[model samples]
Target: MTQAVAADLPIWAALPVALLLLLGAGLALTGTLGLLRLGSFYERVHAPTLGTTLGIGCVLIASMLYFSVLQTRPVLHEVLIAVFMTVTTPVTLMLLARAALYRDRREGNDQVPPPPPPPRGGQEEGPDGTTEEMAAMDRAELAERR
Candidate 1:
């Protein structure tokens, strides 16, 4: 069982904790604002990383401090979650961006960069003996044709 203390906390200790919590809230708000204000998909993708990384980091520090002070035991679970999120979020974002690019390219949309040219010297000869370069077909159209 834990007992609550009514005594005033020291300025040094209380100040840092309060500052950390305020910083975390500020970072979260900034990240959310970035998400709303940024233009384009690629630009928007970078906004949430600020919250997931820095905002959560500040909050985690505050959690560790509060828990350690209250229970007299180090609370480290937030560290694990922070590490996992940092490692996985970038990978997931990369995959999603790649998938979006692929989909857009398949639709012949001009928003994405053009794919690399096909290999040379594999041209098939037509009935008229003229050789033609093989062009990549739209993925969605190919799927529909199939």
Candidate 2:
């Protein structure tokens, strides 16, 4: 943001603009820190979204407010850019993450789903897809009929 644009802003507006800018910077910094410090792969995937969403949003909104008051016009281009970014960032992030997962799976990395647990004593499945308990009951009824 240009200092010239905000030179004429009143203290009330200036305070908010400065505060918002600082907040935006702080969010972005936190996002970067999270990406570096977090241990899990999935946790890292979502770290930058904080910056992409609220950090950039706050900065853009502050710019919009500043320029609108300074230029005495609507200062709408920033708003449009902000809207576009807010909507697209998450979608693109998701698509990228999904693509990475697909690639990893296709390449047969160590990301396979865990094996199904062995059936327990009373819950063993029969070959025909019935449980052992049910098959045993069926056999008892057949003997009675005979």
Candidate 3:
């Protein structure tokens, strides 16, 4: 389809769209670099999630502004894409992290932290031999447990 010439775009709309596209591209590049440079799985997951979400948001906002101004009507397709992305990205991150944690723990990876102690009633001793309230225990008793 034939597109409108750049000359048709006003200074008001052109400037913000240009800035937003640049900002979005920079954020996406940062996230990509973070994913490559980070050492651990947990750390690696965070960069892309933040980067892509914010980057896409900026780009989408720019698109909305450009099309809305050019057409003289509200353009909203970006809203749906933004909504789906905002909702799903973090959720996918959590699911991946949890799965990795579970796998690492199951395989007895030393780097993973120990599971939290199970719930206890009042002052019952946990399976690990420490009580729910360690503060109430004397130093000698605490040492004895260890």
Candidate 4:
């Protein structure tokens, strides 16, 4: 490393990078732990976003600061990286969960709720109609159809 670059990074500048790196690591670890400990698929899928959003954010900001100081110019690559990560993480999680659900459903697993039963032909009634009235109306409609 050049002496000029080394001189630019004083203790004050390095402090933010150190704090960010540590914070980012801790958040990532917490997210991983949550992923492991969470019981359900939805919770597990959501846990990693902690790492993707805030964790990566801290680390990226630190990188941007360090590189900018070293290069004597604004380093914006990390900003792009952070933005790309934020946009992609949730979408990726959703796709993966959807694929998993599809596979489970294809195998006839009962992991997800089944489709609702088809509607029966009956006289349209408002919310005031009772269950017995609906059943009678449906029966009359069925008899008429027959």
Candidate 5:
């Protein structure tokens, strides 16, 4: 009896649901390919953004559709999660990129732009006749010194 009831459930919706899942899979695949094909870390970062945004969007949409249909009620928890992810992912990516830039600069890596040259006047002298410039060390130079 349960088998008949389950079998009688509308199967037509599967078409749309499957299509959505396939779309999500394709987006994720493309994003992965972009991550591999890109030349630099900065460029590669954008690839995952696509997957984290649109790929997840499609999957969430599919989940909402499937659950709503099966349960005969609107399922919206996935929507909230999707919204939160979309909002937070970019912020996280930005922070990571900034951190990478900071570390690379500190390491004096050639891949990133060098920090601005120190102020002129050979170094500002303090009241004690010591140079103020010597008081604060350049991050890259300090790292090299160590």
Candidate 6:
């Protein structure tokens, strides 16, 4: 079947498609700026994730709409692409976060919290029913000993 060109589309369908494409491009650009401008890895990871997901969604929806109209049938390949991105992006973010945290802690970076102490058997819990006080006390004793 011959494909319908953009110029041949009725105004009703063309306007939304054009708007969506522009919006998608804008969102993607914003994300790119965020990635470049953010200072920290933690802060930086979020921008692209949100930006790309929403941006791509807009672009894909536009493509789906334009093609569906052109072919006079519901074009759905974009759905698969959207689902794949939605599934992968968050998983990638988490993995990168964990890896960065691990590397930072290994290098003794002070920004991240220290690893929790090993569990002790039969240790009396503090009034708050937590080992927080005990850990603090132990840390204090170690400091004094040194």
- Considering only N, C-alpha and C atoms within 3 Å, which residue pairs clash in candidate 1? none
Number of clashing pairs per prediction, in order: 0, 0, 0, 0, 0, 0
- Measured over all alpha carbons after superposition, the RMSD of each candidate to the real structure, in angstroms, is 10.8, 11.5, 7.0, 10.4, 9.6, 8.2
Off by over 4 Å in 5: 1-12, 115-146
Please tell me which predicted candidate would have the highest TM-score against the true structure. 6
Q: Candidate 3 regions off by >4 Å?
A: 1-7, 119-146
Give the per-residue lDDT of model 2 (tens digit) for 1-146: 65554267888889999999999999999999999999866678889889888999999989988988888888888878888997888898889877777777778778645333444455455577656667776665566558
Model 6 over residues 12-110: C-alpha lDDT tens digits? 999999999999999999998999999988889888975669999999999999999999999999999999999998898899999999999999999
lDDT of 3 at 49: 68
lDDT by residue (tens digit), candidate 1, 65-108: 76666566888888898899889988999999999888989999
Best by lDDT: 6
Q: How high is the CA lDDT of each candidate model?
A: 0.77, 0.81, 0.84, 0.83, 0.82, 0.86
Runs in model 2 lying further than 4 Å from the true structure: 1-6, 111-146
TM-scores of all candidate predictions against the true structure: 0.70, 0.68, 0.75, 0.68, 0.69, 0.75
Instruction: List runs of model 1 lying over 4 Å from the truth.
Output: 1-10, 118-146
**lDDT, model 6:** 0.86
In model 6, how many backbone clashes occur? Answer: 0
Model 4: weakest 10-residue lDDT segment is 114-123
Per-residue alpha-carbon lDDT of candidate 3 for residues 24-94, written as tens digits (9 for 90 to 100): 98999999999999999888888886567999999999999999998899999999999999898878888
Put the candidates in lDDT order, highest first.
Answer: 6, 3, 4, 5, 2, 1
lDDT of 6 at 116: 59
Question: Which portions of model 6 miss their true places by more than 4 Å?
Answer: 1-7, 119-146
